[model samples]
Target: MPATILIVDDNELNLRLATRVLEKDGYQTTTALNGFEALELCDQNPPDLAILDVMMPDMDGYELCRRMRENPKLKHTPIIILTALSSVDDRLQAFDVGADDFLSKPFVPAELLARVKVFLRHLEVRAVGNENQMARKIAVFSLRGGVGVSTLATNLAAGMSQLWGDETALVDMAFFNGQSALMFDLPMRNTWGDLAQIPEEEIDAEVLNQVMLRHSSGTRVLAAPRSAVNADQISEEKVSHVFELLQEQYPYIIYDLPHDFSATTLVALDSADKILLLIAPELASVRAAGMALTVFEELGYPDEKVELVLNWNFQSQGLPRGEIEAALKRKLSIVIPYVADSIVTAITMGKPPILSMPETPLGALFEDLAFRWSAPEQKKKRPESPTDAWRRIAERMRKRAKAASS
Candidate 1:
């Protein structure tokens, strides 16, 4: 069935124009000349998405949006605010009132269509997985330190959240000295320490939600404790329970693991849907990765469950890719090139490359990698309307395949 969109504008011509543009694309559109009529229409039948003009009689777009968000039936509906006001303050006010996107008045029809398509595509992707679907847990681990394990985990989590616009969890399992919160510039308001005192069976969704820190990129972080003593109080049982609860809440979870097979680390590794074993180009990193692989094999993990990721952390005196692959006896699924300056700057600014510099080579690489690790069901089926991020990744893949063929 074609998705329905509700267009609300006081101007008759503006309403007709928006309606015509949407209907031309096969979307069923209902028009309203005022906020009261829009609410009445919505009460009768809710739309999959809504386009609202900010300048309306009696009730402006901001109030209309707030009322819709308050309505149980319209709370999750995607809203795009259209207005002549193009100031940053106006855009921020629109967002504050729960608008998903903003467009200027006299907007290009193509731009409107593009934005609508993206929202609908996201809705379709979300609908594909119901409540029964468990989160895809990805654990980034390295037996050796300083191999950019935490860096990769942060980028992957942030990238996935940005791509899907869904809440992705980033669990800092490096409880002793995890920097996941710092990477995103989140304050350590609540952490695993908050959950440590609670009995494992007593920990529930509401409690977990309080402990998780929200990021602008839609990534919620389970930050490590500030004190080592608090970290030590977190037991393996608590970690297991937290993972089980997180799987129910988030569609994706990224684990930034410590450099040992500790009880807490094992709990995360054992629960992971996919394990990314990160290694640098040096011999020790390769040896450490090999040992980790052996342990995974011993633990009965399937070959496909664990993937090798080669990080070129150093600019010089690094082993070749072939040598590292030979030493580890596994093909590298992803290779992150050396971008020390970029990485350092991103860290210092409390931003991940994927969020701050998405157009840069490093940012694009992480974003693409995050998409590759998305939920299998989401990747297996193409969306009815592809999002811009999806199209960009698909185009990149096509170009790469073509180059290889030629």
Candidate 2:
């Protein structure tokens, strides 16, 4: 049976257009001229998803959405607000009313269908109740700057989103000067600055959603503030609360941490499930990693929880991997081969290799890293509705299992 959609709009022409387009695409669509009729229809038979227009005379979409959320029978159904009001305020209102998505009016059919597909697919998965995997929180760090910490963090977050088609968040904890948003080519519409002054008690899912910037690749970014002064306004407690909220909502959370071990940095590092402590193939980076390891030990963080990654940022001669491992007293868990030209181009183009070139060496490396460190439960069970990315994961798992047995 096809998924049913309820499209509520006051304009008959708009209703017919949406209904025809959706039905033509093999979805079962029902239409209503106002929110009252839509509510009556929902009571009779709730839709899998609701596409509501905002300007209904009987009751606006925002009110209808709030009422629908309060309805026990229709609470879990995803609601998407479609309106000509494309302003940020309108979108924020929709989110406040419990909308799962928002689309501006005069939307393309393909874009509408794509959003519907993702919404339905997520609904189907939730209906199965197979998602027991807890969110994995990862902190990508380096005591030394320019060791590709942010680069790796960005790719890992984006890669995980692409792989599972689930929500992933990249949190830029480098409050002073973070570039997670720039790497994704996202405008500084909303960032951590929004939450810096908000009372800690008021910081919840809704507030966090308002601050997070969504990327085109399905990843969300909690960006650093644009101004350096705003960084101080954000407290360590606020950082902790934000991470707590993110951990509950996102399936994967990657923190792009700053170089120093400040109070805020310590808070994030403490909450992390795994720490990717990156080091370059240079003496300075090696010494920094060693110091970081010593601090991790002092903080009682286990050796297994930290993965020391060797990033070859430059092709010039530097300390050997063996010597670095000996000095740190731990074997390197992963190595990122130098691809200076490609990496530079990726940065300049504002497309991470994971999104722009997943088949490339750097891209595959990040994908493999994401797979290796994901929650163990996710690795054990296959999702009910598998995407192309999921299929690739399954194939990779099979190969790894076979190799291990052999």
- With a 3 Å backbone cut-off (N, CA, C), the pairs that clash in candidate 2 are none
- Model 1 regions more than 4 Å off: 1-130, 384-387
What tens digits encode model 2's per-residue C-alpha lDDT throughout 177-219? Answer: 9999989866666789889878999999767865787665678
lDDT of each: 0.88, 0.86
Q: Model 2 off-target regions past 4 Å?
A: 1-112, 115-133, 396-406
- Measured on C-alpha atoms, candidate 1 has an lDDT of 0.88
